[model samples]
Target: MDIDVFATAHRLEWQRLDALIRRRRRLTGPEVDELVELYQRAATHLSTVRSSGQDPALTARLSGLVARGRSAVTGAHASAWGDVSGFFVRTFPAVLYRMRWWWIGSALLSLALGAGIAVWIMADPQVQAAIGPPEEIRAYVEHDFANYYVEHPGASFAAQVWTNNAWVSALALVLGVFGCLPTVYVLAQNAANLGVAGGLMFAHGKGDIFLGLIIPHGLLELTAVFVAAGVGIKLGWTLIAPGPRPRLQALAEEARAAMAVVLGLVVVLFVSGLIEGFVTGWVHITWLRIAIGVAAEALFLAYVFVLGRKAVHEGETGDIAHRPETAPVAG
Candidate 1:
């Protein structure tokens, strides 16, 4: 005479009866009354089961049956973006609030390490000696700046550079799933090269020339790099600290958030590629280049640091946060 079992069984029967009624089927008033009574009984039983610390298998089974019956009556449909917006609204503020330190710290460390390594390589005479004679280094530098594109005469230089930039950006994002180690390595390697090139430009008294060439696009390109690196770090950290969830579940949640960051970075890289291929080489005026570079940097920083932070905060507690949760349930 376990009332819990009786109530659970009745709930299951009531759900089946509700589904039958929804399918344009006829049900007498007494049938509807019976269904309501059963539902109430099940609710009461659930409270008792919860208090007793017993497995609620019967309750879960009833719920599943009810869900299946409803699906049968209404038909399956895909969930809309509007339906899931509440999840993003609730989650982003917490994540952004926690992630600010990681983003800033990683950017500073990467920049400082990259610059330090570059300086060391350029200043050490033995290092230069190991790289071979001055003539060889000069030849390499000239090839990199001027002659590399000449070797591939058929392909459109602009197209090639754009394609290569896109591929590299994508690789950075995809490789981040593997604990972000690969992405970090890629970013570090690129930073090292940039540092060396910058050092060489200064040593040869062509620092101004280098600045004019790189400033226009490098502003966007470098920001893209930092964003990608930050995403990878976020993913890796989730695995390290999963809160109350199991590690695998935590990793999956992190991947979803990291994907959003990657999507944002892709847009950045596309703009950077366009600037690099078309504007950087054509715009030779130092003053114009500086203006464009500074403007672009200001805009990017405003969006990434200021606007992004505000959006996350508003999303968590504003009207936008409730819209998704209140969306019509998919039939």
Candidate 2:
């Protein structure tokens, strides 16, 4: 019965229902109605899973979720600290894993566009002149770009850059609702800007300097951005094609996840900002700086592919997974 497809189609409803059942002392009238509807849908899903698949795990998980819903849904609630930890360890990574394809595609497409733009600028004098006058371009390539990192105190700069990047990431996610056009526009502008800078640097024989300064922080920073763009695109697409679910419900579900997704992105960008401010400019050894950047990028990839994959395998989807009740199940 294509269990994965079924789960993906309905997981959001389950998550919403689980949340309504577990938390919130008060539910609005609509939310209460949603809870009841979700409960019924989950029961149908459980029945489907049991009848069509030999997946004991799916059955047990759904059974637990249904049981809780049946019981006006209770909990032996995890501590606030544990909940926070779980959000990072489980929920956040699951979202990353789930959205991996979208972001990866975004990253590849943006990179290709940036590279193409850089090549065009380098190959054509008209393009180069259109970017800027020679003197201004040379100044940017030789001095301004490098000086940007060191112009401000590291701590303050890091904070400022973090806030800015976080806002950009959040904006990318939020703007997804209007349509992918806005999100695509944002990504295109960023790629074009980067391409212009890179083309100018390479043309002026400062390519090494550019990479050295940018890679350490740029790797992780751009990744965070790509993640946002991807999620945003998906959110926008949700409005257009909600698959089996109703359109508004699909949008609401995605929007809720998008909001939570921003919190994790803030932390990701803060790390990138620290590296940009402290390591990119201050670290004297070029190899060491580049190595640090590589390490950060590697670490982030591992975090998503490893922890994120694990979380998804266990049905985590950046929301409270519909878990089984605390009581022992009868054989």
Candidate 3:
């Protein structure tokens, strides 16, 4: 393979990479460019040597230089706190803003379904009987419904709710790959349960108590769930209709973007869990609790439409910046 000839030809490039690695902190901009160029050349040289049965020592030296050069070019990562702040400020909201309509539709449909079920349960005597006897229904409405929240220690209950809600949101996102059918099933089950509870309460003449306790945390909690389901369903639909991109590529892009929602919803659900645990049962005032829930929901909406819009305008797609993206091409 004339190893010596190749070594003599590329020694200068290898040396440059070594020099750049040694003085990475002091390199001028041009020198930094030169370092990257040399790093690329050194990598090529190593590949050629490996394939051509070159001397082991020469191959090892080039390999070390290329490794060091790669590190110098990429630099270190930002702090953990910086990553967390960036996700909330830019990535999370930007995704929420971009995917707003999908979630909004989900919210409307789920709410309507819930309300319809409630109405059916309230008006149909057969359904009420199937649910249970009138006395049991009244007892549940008067006691068991609200008592469920206070039966456990607040902290423990909050933890349980946080974990359960997080799991459900995560399921919607992960199962979305198979098409949105699974996610829809999960949402339907939840809506049905909510409807039965609301209807039972209303039938027993405890409508105010029902809304007062449920509205506080359920507002934000359910919104987060809706968002999760919406994103999941959208991701699934991407497979069915990938637009201009290939199906696999479209799925990858949507999955990457939707994952941000999963993480963001965890925090949202945690806040809701706190409200459900401490505020719903602990706070005896109906109006004040509902007001707190409304305020939290408002803040979430503002954060998405305002900060999210700004980030989207600035070219953030909720995908991590360093990750490889599909390159744009002219048609």
Give the best candidate by lDDT.
3
Report the lDDT tens digits of candidate 3 across residue range 1-331.
7999988887777776787889999999999888888878877887898777547666666666666677788885568899999999999999999999988988898889999999999899899999998789878988999899899999999999999999988887777778789988888888999999999999878999899999999999999989998898899889999999888878888888998998899899999999998999899888999999999999999999999999999999987564422232233
Please identify model 2 stretches exceeding 4 Å from their true place.
1-75, 320-331
Per-residue lDDT tens digits for candidate 2, residues 1-331, read: 7888988898888888889987545888887777778888898988998887556677888898887877663445678899889888988888989989989999999999999998888888899998788899878987899999999999999999998888888777778778788988888888998898888888778889989898989999999999999999999999988999878767777776776678889889989999998999999899999999999999999999999999899877775355442223333
Give TM per candidate: 0.65, 0.76, 0.80
In model 2, what is the error at residue 51, expressed in angstroms? 20
> Backbone clashes per model, in order?
0, 0, 0
Collision pairs in model 2: none
Evaluated at residue 30, the lDDT of candidate 3 is 95
Clashing pairs in 3: none
Candidate 1 clashing pairs, residues 3+ apart or interchain: none
Tell me which of candidates 1 and 2 scores higher on TM-score: 2
Question: What TM-score quantifies how close candidate 2 is to the native fold?
Answer: 0.76
Better of 2 and 3 by lDDT: 3
Those runs of model 3 whose alpha carbons end farther than 4 Å from true positions after fitting are 1-77, 325-331
Candidate 1 vs 2: which has more lDDT:
2
